[model samples]
Target: MSKHQLKAVYVISVAAELAGMHPQTLRIYERRGLVSPARTQGGNRRYSDDDIELLRRISELTDEGMNLEGIRRVMQLEDENVQLRRELEQAREIALHAIREAERAGARGGGGGDLVPLKQAVAVFGQRPSIFDRD
Candidate 1:
């Protein structure tokens, strides 16, 4: 199957129809600061796929007995967690790639030295006295 295009924006009515909600409900969500729709030159609101998905999430949270304020806080925390996870994953990938690149460069330099174990990279930077040091 082809990948879906998420770049398109729907008008308030169309978005409401797609989300199984009324246009006024969408406006209420905007008023609650739950979803921010884009504005056209004529100042009409346009809801993107992401906005619709957020609306659905807000609806689900509300259905689950969460107040609007609680939903807002939950959504904020979820967004932050997702961002942090992405950053951590990216950092891990970069570290792994750097290790591979360094190994390749070392192999080409004709050092013929044994490859250091992954655990030793931290020690290579020098032993800073740690408060938790047992030794």
Candidate 2:
């Protein structure tokens, strides 16, 4: 978590004020599963900066006439999109590292008979095996 996300410093009232909403409105949002603020040891709700930003986004979506369920779905898809992008970036980095290792091995005369290049092909297996077929 980023520093802003790690620090749940704002109380519900302060968060509501920052998000341009009433405190009760914040509670309603929580009840609707729109926002989940952090809880203190005493069970008080504490909002991080990220939470405030999310509240603002919810307010925007609501102002645009989206229902709560629609907003929740949109948010879920947005989070999934971000996670997929991160995973793709990590995969690209891993591929590049493997390519570099292969290049280094070839440079040092290590790419000999030990490593065989693979030929990728598709196999169709719809037909059943027959005793007449030779191995």
Compose the digit string of candidate 2's lDDT tens values, residues 1-135. Answer: 446446999999999999999999999999999998888778999999899999999999999999999999999999999999999999999999988888888878884624575555454588654543554
**Local distance difference test values of all predictions, in order:** 0.80, 0.88
lDDT for model 1 = 0.80
Which is the leading candidate under lDDT? Answer: 2
**Candidate no. 1 TM-score:** 0.68
Alpha-carbon shift of residue 53 in model 2 (angstroms):
0.6
Q: Which candidate is the best by TM-score?
A: 2
